[model samples]
Target: MALFLLAFGVWSWLLWPTFLRNILGDEQSWSNGSPTAFLWVHVVIAVVSLVLGTVIGVLGWRAHRANRRS
Candidate 1:
């Protein structure tokens, strides 16, 4: 599960810029909206993934500790 979340986070991190461009509009061609606005959405996704990854790591650590204690 941690590995999956880590993979997802990495995937999103890799794609975030591309996704932002798609949302805002292509840089090399005609663009219609504020790139900054779409950038915030990208920021949100990044922040959420960071938070989720941290949570997953913490949970995994706790589980490991519990297992070791028993």
Candidate 2:
């Protein structure tokens, strides 16, 4: 579920703006706005961090469970 949310969030950041642009033309609209370079970099970081955090959390949880069982 977390992975799915992460993927969705990433895809939304990447494609949603362009999709809105297509519907509303080049000019800014209520739905679709052009993304700045800074925004793109931020989005990438957000996606990466989400995935990395999830992996780290899972590993920690597994280790904790193993220690309990032992």
Candidate 3:
């Protein structure tokens, strides 16, 4: 589980920036010089996911270390 969480967190870190870049460049992401709902929603989701992933990864790492010590 800890390893899974760590992998997930790393995946999120690697994925979100590229996804955000794609979203920013996508035509559907903009409308009349403003960002569309699609862009906003995706950005929010990505940000939240990144934060959660980092937290979960840290917890997982701590758990892994604790287990090693026990």
The top-ranked prediction according to lDDT is 3
Steric clashes per prediction: 0, 0, 0
Question: How close to the true structure is residue 28 of candidate 3, measured as C-alpha lDDT?
Answer: 96
Top candidate when judged by TM-score against the true structure: 3
Q: What lDDT tens digits, residue by residue, belong to model 3 across residues 1-70?
A: 8788788888888998899899999999999999999999999998998999899888888888888899
Clashing pairs in 3: none
The lDDT of model 3 is 0.89
lDDT of 2: 0.54
lDDT of each: 0.58, 0.54, 0.89
Q: Candidate 1 lDDT, tens digit per residue, 1-70? A: 5455546555655765566557445453333543454456566875676667566656666666666789
**By descending TM-score, how would the candidates be arranged?**
3, 2, 1
Question: TM-scores of the models, in the given order?
Answer: 0.50, 0.54, 0.89
lDDT of 3 at 34: 98
Off by over 4 Å in 1: 1-35
RMSD of 3: 1.0
